[model samples]
Target chain A: MGKVAREVVEKAGINVDELVKKLVRAAGAEFTTYYYYTILRANAIGFDGEGIKEIIEDMRIEDRNHFEALVPRIYELGGELHRDIKDFCKDAACPDAYLPSNPRDVKALLQVLIEAERCAIRVYADICALTAGKDPRTYELSAAIMNEEIEHEAWCSEFLGEGPSGHFRRGAPGESPYVSRFLVVPKPGV
Target chain B: MERRWVTIADSSELAADGVKGFSVGDKRIVVVRYRGRYYAFDAACPHMAGPLDEGTIVEGRLECPWHHYLYDLESGENYYPKNVYPDDLKHTVAPLRKYPIRETEGKLWVALEDAKA
Candidate 1:
């Protein structure tokens, strides 16, 4: 742990340890969501499933990107991910987005996806609200991830034909316009 | 230990349809007022410990802000899953713990040990 890095947030009157716990849990949610989405993406098939499958794939990779982005900040704040993989899943901040019993029912599948994204939006919004102005880096990172989550919700809502979400689909697979910069991995084709 | 009365908040802090959070001896308790009655329950969500102080009371249920898991303010039972969730998931969402609360002398008092299931 960098003494100076840790003290900055502590001196700001924030409980660094609590904040780190929140970050770690948020990261755990992203990591687990990525895994569940993989199952959803695979089961999303056939005629009706084709369209939503693309969206699911996009969200899957972006959630993975979010996990990749959050880990470094967790360490920077003097926290570490659980060594046990099961513990990581158990520590997820949001409930798992289990695939519906009838994966063939596209509507049910979309509902599960939309609810997961909504939970993610609330999670990041709380973190953003807590760390705003006091911790710039975490705040900025959360805001970026929240942007994608909001878009994901919009996409699922639109696919369900709920109404116009006033957003377009991604230009390419894994087009993480907002959170890509925070990723430690180099951008594709860079 | 026997249950003891603990003063939690001034009456004025909780307006009708309002919620307030108070920490009592390491226990975080949230008080909610609805229909001119007050109810108290554990403030941390049974799901993820999301602060229930940040949650909203909807149709007599306290909705956790993190994932929107709701608990009936009166019964402290997980409210929506019975209708919104599948047959299996309804059994998985845990009910919140509730404490006995009363208002007297312009202050709110809660029974520390007698938590309703």
Candidate 2:
């Protein structure tokens, strides 16, 4: 717990407990999404699925980046992840991004991916709205994550034949354009 | 036992699937209008105390937004992960507390006492 850091947020008249709870859930969502996406990415085979593997990999690793970036801020705000792994997973803010019942149906898979990204966008947007002005550090971090989530949604949506994403590939896949600066561990390749 | 009923809102104010949270003294309560009927329960999820008011109601069950643990709106029974949850673990966590609600004269009221089986 950062004594001074906690004190500053408390003095700002924010409910530290509520804020911490939200942060923990957000982190849990990111972590669990990373795990689930890996499965989805691995199963990305066949005609349409193979074509989109690159995008799935990009989103998968970026979600992991988000989880890494969020932990330090959680501890800084005096929040601790549950010692029990079950508890941590059970508290994830978003629903599980379950693989489609028919894995071979590429459209079904895309639907799942698009919905998960949309949920993430909402989660970060809510955090950003709550922390704006009241807690600058969390606000900035959440805003950064929100930007990535938005881009991720666009990429998945474009694949669904919705509309053009207006985005080219990242300089490299899963570059963590907005959140990499906050990660303590060096990314494998930036 | 005597039941104390408190008026929480007018029936017209709640649309189908609408969820509202209220602070009755120190207790947080959530009321949901589902399938033309209203159900009331403790606002916090048993797992992590997630705000139940923010969760979605589907197929007669309300899901906790945090972990997606589900409870039947009427019976307050754990509807998901019961078969998967360890037997001892199931017994350890608290189940949702449901309060009886009545609609009369265009208003909805909740009894302070737990609903009788």
Candidate 3:
């Protein structure tokens, strides 16, 4: 097993540790969507396009639902829901500042959401695989979370009016160049 | 058996500003030249195996087109900033793996050894 998984098994008691990790991973996934929607809502103001505005608003609520579902699991695992925005930001794989330049654009907003959903799918899959048969409760929780993420991905794809694979092409028009410019280089021969 | 050096492409095809993809012996590789030096690595992103050829080159790193995970060309390290967790979770660290690279005669090469072998 990897060092992180082994350390987690040792420090927090196998059952509780797996539960905590799974919950944190689920919450972390929702946090990314929540952060994106919050920015999108702020950018939607003054835009007279009601359809675009409504879509953004609806997604904001869906993300909130995901966050709410994670609260009880966090408590069950003897861990506090990460309430502080700074803490959430600290744990994010991609920083909030790297958000889209034009959040009012539905295309750009959906792009970010799709990316978040993909990451969530991977994280939840890992959690479910690790906890399967070991902690049935966490296994079930991860399975449910994965289903929700799949729905989110589908919704984003539908909103873009393109097949799921279409978003991988050139970035949205007028989107921030910084998002593409910011590269994460790994260490040598890791 | 016959010795072959398929002309993948000219080195100039990959300028300092961008990255290019090539195939050799069924192995896909990405050639990135940064600061006038060429470096090569697996053409897929480590995060989700996204195509690195479709990604952009920034500074000395190749940014994954999928989730924007960056990999340094020379060292193959993730250039993205590290996540700083709370003191309670400081012990958790997730780092990406890197691959070997070589540049000779203006052509880049990467090792393609099967782990099981």
Global lDDT of each candidate: 0.85, 0.82, 0.55
Candidate 1 local distance difference test against the native = 0.85
Error of 2 at A94 (Å): 1.6
What's the TM-score of every candidate structure?
0.84, 0.73, 0.48
Q: Which stretches of candidate 1 lie over 4 Å from their true place?
A: B1-8, B15-18, B22-28, B34-37, B48-69, B72-75, B79-86, B99-105, B109-115
In TM-score terms, which candidate is top?
A: 1
Candidates by DockQ, descending order:
1, 2, 3
Which 10 consecutive residues of model 3 chain A have the lowest summed lDDT?
A: A174-183
Tens digits of per-residue lDDT, candidate 2, A83-151, equal 998888877877667676666777777777876786687677777877888899998999999999999
Which digits, one per residue and each the tens of the lDDT, describe model 1 over residues B1-117?
688899988989987898889999899998899998999988998887888987877677887765556688878888643333555777878888889899999999999877866
Candidate 3, residue A59: lDDT: 49
**Candidate 1 local lDDT, residue B112:** 83
Give the lDDT ranking, best first: 1, 2, 3
lDDT of 1 at B5: 93
Two-way lDDT contest, 2 vs 3, winner: 2
Judged by DockQ cut-offs, the docking class of candidate 2 is incorrect
Q: Write the per-residue lDDT of candidate 3 for residues B1-117, one digit (tens) a residue.
A: 233334556676777666888887776777776777666667776655677876667556676654455666656666542221223432332233433445567655455552110
Which candidate wins on DockQ? 1
Give the DockQ (2 decimals) of all models. Answer: 0.30, 0.20, 0.05
Stronger candidate by lDDT (1 vs 2): 1
